[model samples]
Target: MPALNIDFSDEELAELRETAKARGVTLKSLVREAVTEDLAQRRALAAMTAVLRAFTAEHTTAFDDAFPDDAPTGARRRGAA
Candidate 1:
């Protein structure tokens, strides 16, 4: 596994230390878990974006027709149709 180096402010470091202590884990373990969770979250977001892009690309024409061309010119609710 690769090692990561990160920098935090004094107050942030103090908070991390307190949080780790409260969780009964070492500072290093807490940092590792945070980094792992962040990376997983980023990957999940990337996957979702890719899927949305692919879906739109595949259905551009039909998706466009799903709405009416005479939509309220600006952002206004015309009337209760």
Candidate 2:
């Protein structure tokens, strides 16, 4: 693992340091844990979005058939239909 230099505002640095001390963890570990959780969350969200898009694409025809006026193809217009 490579170390990276990150600059933080004085107030933010103080808060992070205080939290690390209270939790009995190094600031580096705290930051690393946050980054790891955020990356996992992003990956999970991406996967969920892909599944939703695939499901929508697979059933778009059924949706369009059920609701022609409110179809995703912008059939709805102001004061029309």
Candidate 3:
């Protein structure tokens, strides 16, 4: 129930208004939907990043063993350096 005030260039406002009208939504509704979708995408990205980090931490040695040539010079299994 809080109000947010955002300023847009005249051209940007015109484009947003036109797009909202074409989609049969009020400008406020259009902006709200866009914000919701953006937040969802950001949350998904954060989760994906965490999963990837965990995978790398757990599998780095396995990967290095599987492809020994990919390992750093004389350094394999995470501490052969």
lDDT of each: 0.80, 0.84, 0.89
Encode model 2's per-residue lDDT on 1-81: one tens digit a residue: 788899999999999999999999999999889899999999999999999978977777788788877775553322123
> What's model 2's lDDT at 62?
80
User: Against the true structure, candidate 2 has what lDDT?
Assistant: 0.84
Query: For model 1, where is the 10-residue window of minimal lDDT?
Result: 72-81
Superior by TM-score: candidate 1 or candidate 2: 2
TM-scores of all models? Answer: 0.73, 0.80, 0.87
Q: Report the error of model 1 at residue 47, Å.
A: 0.8
lDDT of 1: 0.80
Using lDDT as the measure, which candidate wins?
3
List CA RMSD, all candidates.
7.5, 5.2, 2.6
Q: What is the lDDT of residue 2 in candidate 1?
A: 80
Per-residue lDDT of model 1, residues 1-81, tens digit only: 887789999999999999999999999999989988999999999999999978866765464456657344433323323
Tell me the lDDT of model 1 at 77: 26
TM-score of 2: 0.80
